[model samples]
Target: MIGCGIGGAAAIIILVVTMAFPGSTTTTSDSSILVDPTKEKQSLFTLARVMIQNTGNIPLTNITIDYGGGAKDFIPTLKSGKTIILSPPDGNSLQFVRVTADGGIDVYKAYREPVAMPGMMGS
Candidate 1:
């Protein structure tokens, strides 16, 4: 009976540790353009960063990054398998990002904040 109790306690400890430190997240896509947005906490402020990658066999052209509120940036070309990082305009809270380019390459991604609770899954 004592061994059973010890095993149960150990299981609980492992579960709690797992919940406290979650695993990394990975985004996979078969599309020509991949857009990923993430938020990082720095000091006392949270900053958002976006990563764009070209996965096609050919180069892309006329790329645009729309940050909502009429703020946008453009890229003339992106070589195949190339990646770039973008920051939203100053004083803008990054809720989501939309990327578009010629050849029907369009990708929209939202920033997901991680929230872990006892009975909830982290996002």
Candidate 2:
């Protein structure tokens, strides 16, 4: 009746006021760098030549490059328009590469299929 309606309205107002304040939320800044990877084939092995380019106006430092999950390395710094090349253990053998820059991260994946030779059968 009248008492029940007043109680429900008071509860709803209290709930709305409780939700109006900011609580456990957080904010993060993210950024990225440019990366290029090329495949190199040797007599018996293949290699990946990666070029990391800093295109942003800010100078990127303490950059990390992860070649799949097997290997990782760090670069001291990369100024704008600067580039660095990296050769993984084996060219094109790794399926993924991850680069962590100043405030952002980038992941690159390569999926390659072998082309059939003149007389090569299925696969």
Candidate 3:
């Protein structure tokens, strides 16, 4: 099951570190990693899946995610089957929020707005 550190970027990271899945913990800065897709989906807030590999041959628990650029954060989920799902905040302007997991830094740019959906054709 996924643990704490879902919303509110600041306090999230601390909870993640407590898990320490990767055996060793490495602190990451805000400007290190980056995520794609500038907007969130309607049925779902965010469709971004982050793959965190504990290359050190250990399990890293207590993972956390922080969003910089002042954008709100989302609920945290485990990377099941190597893919972790993320839900976005209520606001429309994500404004390129940053991410920090298990002390690993990352940046995500969610679309300000969604694009046209399918079935618009033949109208």
List TM-scores for all candidates, in order.
0.64, 0.56, 0.34
Once superposed on the true structure, which residue ranges of model 1 sit more than 4 Å away at CA?
1-31, 114-123
> By TM-score, is 1 or 2 better?
1
Residue lDDT tens for model 1, 1-123: 999999999999999997654432223333377677777655567767777888777787899989888889899999988999888888766887788888877677676555534654331
lDDT (Cα, tens digit) per residue for candidate 2, span 15-105: 8875552121111242346666555444565545667777666677788878875688899888867778887764334666677765645
Top-down lDDT ranking: 1, 2, 3
Candidate order by TM-score, decreasing, is 1, 2, 3
In terms of TM-score, how similar is model 2 to the real structure?
A: 0.56
Those runs of model 2 whose alpha carbons end farther than 4 Å from true positions after fitting are 1-32, 90-92, 111-123
Candidate No. with top lDDT: 1
For 18-95, candidate 3 gives per-residue lDDT tens digits of 443222223343212223333434453444333333333233344454444354444343332233435444543444
Candidate 2 lDDT score relative to the true structure: 0.62
lDDT of each: 0.74, 0.62, 0.39
After best superposition, candidate 2 residue 79: deviation in angstroms? 0.8
Worst 10 residues of 1 by lDDT: 22-31
